[model samples]
Target: MPAFKQTQRVHDDAFDPSDSASAHLYISFGAHRIRMGVLDAQRNKFVALEDYEVERPSTVENAISFLQTQSVSNPLLQERKWQQVRIGVKNQQFTLIPEALFDLNAREEYLRLNAVVEPEHEMVHHHEHPRLELINVFTLPAALHEWSVPQFKNSPVEFVHQTSALMEGMLHMAERSARPHLFIYVDKNYVTLVVLQGLKLEFCNSFFFTSSEDFIYYVLFVLQEKKMNPDQDAVTVWGELLLDSELHEILRTYIRHVQFGKKPTGVGFSYRFDALFNHRNFDLYSLHFCD
Candidate 1:
């Protein structure tokens, strides 16, 4: 297993490790990276953020072992007991069902329509979206469950899919505006598109692409299929995109009102975070809104 390399670490000057009892911990697990942040619930502010990158492991056991070994020396993942803990699993193996028709016993069946679920190796979980009136059925590697349960035994923990956080973040943004909006979240090779008309969720799906052309094609295709005018409907984006990059240029050429999303509202961040792009880590930051 390749080592986990530290990529970014930023913390406020007032951060105190001993004060974790009043803070909330948010962690996101992804294919290539793992990110965690600490939020002071009393102040409604984030005090620390850390990101790590690891070479892709060949198998599931290697991935769990790599994290286990790294957690031994990492203070953040150690003995601290937080006020609350939330974990976000990022992947395409998720599907949404109407809350009215959802069945807890059929979680695997609901997810099987879109993904190949191996119950022996994974645990199926569901998150209810009261605002959207839907239930998100997803899977987390069983190894992850085994590893995290004992690590945070002192604190209460809840698990959610990354899309749930993104949707909640987007819906919160829509509440401030009455107009129809299309939100796009881009990753290295996958893009999640969400459409909202005022506060209603009209569309949500993730697409995999290999090139810039493929990325733009899916974005435009979704707009056309939804009868949204590329020149009129506003499109907000979040993730690893540069203002002068090829993807941004392509987006601007095809869409008139393309803008990057902002960091979550209703929560504050330290001034040290000003150097980071507001759009970058939107999903990780939005985990605060999941519960």
Candidate 2:
């Protein structure tokens, strides 16, 4: 059994749990961590962000059981009157299919092409990107899905893969750009890369890396394979890396215009969130745009 440690938490003084009816809750579940964000819908502002880290669960069953225990003691998770609840699953168990080729009845079959799926233990889910004309088919622990629905009885609980969130956020950022832009999201031991030409997605995938060398290798590989000029194209980064970190330094050494991304626009943020870096939770905040 493992315990979850709170790594970060920030909220405006005006935040109130009783007002959950007017707020949207976003939760992102990763290999060994959970990140949550609360948006005050009425004010169009984000009021809270919390992060928790736990030892990687041995199985999906274990992960769900661990969350079940934590939810009971968490005031925000207990609230059932949220305006909306969005859950972002962060894993490699997903595949994106063009809307025209997607078969509603073959979600499991489509995902199996990229990853092994145990239908008996997991439930398949899909999120459609009308703007992208793509459908993302993924899975979650069957027990987890069953448990989450009741918790949001009065609100809709929508599930999506983290990459879907990234696509939505990146498209929003690339709206006015005429050139292809590269975006990278780094997590504990994985990095998700997305290449966009304005609003159109050109490439997207995730790679696992254990060291700095491996990280740089995958990044440079992608740039070269995509025929992108390292000296000309711009790269925007988000998630766990820092401005002064070794990863950022290595990236700048090779790529000409490497910069950290800002939080998604069109939504306000409380001053309390200023303490966090602007790019910290791009995926969580992007859930607001996931329809």
Candidate 3:
């Protein structure tokens, strides 16, 4: 079996260029845990760092436990830069008592809580919406507007600008990693595509397909759409959907019509942040998908 390599990041705020950034961090307030890594930005691979988990507790003692666990005689505790702790709590219905305690500190902020940590949650929710933990502000993206997201009452899911921007940012981050190949994630039943530029170069892209047949037709249709002849350019797919045989064949059938190459296959399921966060803030957004 191939060994798994780990990376640690401490967020850009924690890094001072004069000092080497030994940590890379991806934080999910809902998860209450920070994915950390000491990354070789050059290789875009993780080195190592301890994963810090902040738990969900309602009492002052539990809060104390969080502080102690995270601050216990650890090397990170010794760093002055790590001292200005800012806490963000997930939205909870903690009776009036705990809620008042949580408001005592200016260093703390509360955000609506959504993700759960049980194994079942990882399997169900995570897969159902692959990009949840990876996007901006810990929410789903806008592209999910077309999905029929389940909801309370008779409402539909909504998309927002910030969420879209964050997803776009994650894609651009992958590109900035300048690593070749694609970073694929699927959760729920939505698919997201992102290609990296190992050379640290930037390129433009257009949404090319939604299905195998769509993949085939779009290639040729887009060429004509852009006033280009079928025998013009080349195409390469970087998606899991390309793994299916039937779709692959469908893609190949129309390859001759366009200068693009290969068979078409399939895709991933994902969630964008804006679509699933802050019910009070974006109440109009129906949790259900588009009609």
- Writing each residue's lDDT as its tens digit, candidate 3 over 1-291 gives 121122222233333422223322221122233322233334333222333333332333333344344444534333322211212222221111122234333211222343332332111111011332221222231112111132111222223222222223333333223233332222112223233354221222223244656544544554454443434333344323333455546645654431211111121111221232121111011111111
Provide the clashing-pair count of each candidate structure.
0, 0, 49
The lDDT per prediction is 0.87, 0.87, 0.28
- State the TM-score for model 2: 0.95
Report the lDDT tens digits of candidate 2 across residue range 168-254: 988877755777778999987889999988788888998888898899999998898888999999899999998888898999999
Off by over 4 Å in 2: 55-59
Off by over 4 Å in 1: 55-63, 176-179
lDDT for model 1, on a 0 to 1 scale? Answer: 0.87
C-alpha-based local distance difference test score of model 3: 0.28
TM-scores for every predicted model: 0.95, 0.95, 0.28
lDDT of 1 at 146: 95
